[model samples]
Structures are given as C-alpha cells and as structure tokens.
Target: MSGVVVDVRGLAPVQRFINRLANPDLRALADSLGAELESQTRRRIAEEKTAPDGSPWAPWSAVHAATRHAGHSLLQGDGDLLDSVTYQVSGTQIRWGSPLVYAGVMREGASQGQFGTTRRGGPIPWGDIPGREFLGLSAENEDDLVGITEDWLQELMP
Candidate 1:
C-alpha cells in the first residue's frame, strides 16, 4: 500500500462544507441569531441602558423625566416596548424589532419639529431627543454568532 498525498472532499471536510454553504438552510441559523438579538435588545433597553456599541444612552431631560410617572425608567413607560421585543425568521434573514410606532423614534431619535408642528403650531417634540439605541450586535454578540455558526455548520455536515 502507498501513502496518499491528496484527498478529495475528505481533507478536513472543507469541500463538503463549502458545497453546502451555497444555499444552506437558514431556519436553524436564523432562529439562533434572532433569539440572541431579541435577548440583547431587551437587555439593552431594560438593563444595560446602553447601545450595542457600549455607549450609554442619552439621559432624559429634566422636564421630560418630571413628566413621567414616579420611578419610571427610560423607555419603559408601560413596559410595552420592552415586552414587545421579538424576532422573526424569514428566508435567509433574521429580523427582530418592535411593531410599536415609536420604536423607530426611540432608536433613531428625533429633533424639535421633526414630525411637524403640534396642534397649537409648536414643535411636535418640543425638544430634541437623542437616539437611545437598543438594537444591534455588540462585539460579544458577533463572537457568539461566530461560535453558533460554527456549531450549526458542524451539525449540518453529515
């Protein structure tokens, strides 16, 4: 018997892996990713109070805070937004977010008069609101996804 120097589709399983990568099923992958995103988003809003980039969210203006009920926290008016955090797995995609109308405003912020004047013709928001980002993957999240993907790929291979 002679020692073989070459291998086909069996050298570390790279070929078989690559062949499957072309159009691999995304359901499992999407589910894992979406779940993590949902958890992180809710944590960002309810616990960390920081953006995915690790920056602290802008503090509420004194006037605005005064308007809120006693002991209310940022972005937790009725706990609806945080409770609404959810994820969905679509074909080759994982999208997660809140369906509430103000979700975008909270994520991206708004400037005075951005949404047009109020009924009395004053600025709608009255004051500028800085973005309080609560969605996105942090460095830790990216790393976790990499590990998850590796495990998923291994599971996919025979």
Candidate 2:
C-alpha cells in the first residue's frame, strides 16, 4: 500500500498485454493482487510477527509487557488492528491499509510524548514504543505479486 507504483500501460513487456485489457480485466487483476497482499498482511500479524523483510519485531518493553493480559501479544490487543486490515479496488488501483487512526503511528512508531501530553499532563504514549512493522512489501511479497499478475495475464491469453 505504501510502496512502489506500477504503470502497466507504459512498460514494454506487459505494455501490449496490458493494453489488451478492458477496465474490467484490469479491475480483476487488481483484486487478485489485493487479495494476495491482504493474506500476507494477515499472516504477518497472526503468524510471522515480523517485519515484512523478515526481521523480528522489537520486543515489548518490560513495563508494557507486564500490563498485557496473559494471552495477548504485541499489537494483538482485542484483535482490532488485525481485524481492521482491509483492501479496496477502485478502477485499476488497489489500495489497502487500516482505516484506524492510530495505524500510522503503530507502523512507524512514535516517540514518547511526541504528540504532546494528556489533560492529566502525562506523556501521550505513556512510554516509548518501538516500531513493530506489520504492513509492507518484502521481496517475497513483490515476487508473489508478480506471480499473481503473470497468472492473471495467462488467464487472459487467447
């Protein structure tokens, strides 16, 4: 969602192929790519628990870890973030991300008190939170997208 932009209409190898596409076909391709990416995102949060590049997420701080309930892991509180991940296909564009307001900060992380203090004068974050990147495109993700695109193209072949 926050990565490379492909203009299939201009590229050489796929340009002619892409030109043959109706808007409906383009939309279908977008849907396939979107589904593949969303599945990767869900797996990242629910299973991998690592950055898209496969780096382990920073561990929860001791103070924060102490406050979590027994069954909860980092960012798994109430399952809201995981459930909030979604994607949409509009025209030939595939847009995907969480609509939740805090999603940006969670992905990029925030410095404690960077957003200012609460009414009680406490730090906004209450503590320094490390970034635990859950949404992104890795090499593997890009490869998967290419494969999906190839399959879509094959399906359109005469």
Q: Indicate which candidate wins on lDDT.
A: 1
For model 2, what is the error of residue 134's alpha carbon versus the real structure, in angstroms, after optimal superposition? 1.5
The list of candidate 2 runs beyond 4 A from truth reads 1-24
Which candidate leads the pack in TM-score? 2
Q: Per-model C-alpha lDDT, please?
A: 0.87, 0.85
Over the stretch 23-94, how does candidate 1's per-residue lDDT look in tens digits? 687887889988888987888888899888999988899989889986578888889999999999887688
For residues 1-158, what per-residue lDDT tens digits would candidate 2 score against the true structure?
69998776556756555566653378888888998888999889878889988999898988888889977887788889889999999988888888999888888999999899999999999888788899899899999999998988787654
Q: Estimate each model's TM-score.
A: 0.78, 0.82
RMSD of 1: 4.7
Model 1 TM-score, 2 decimals? 0.78
**CA RMSD (A), model 2:** 11.8
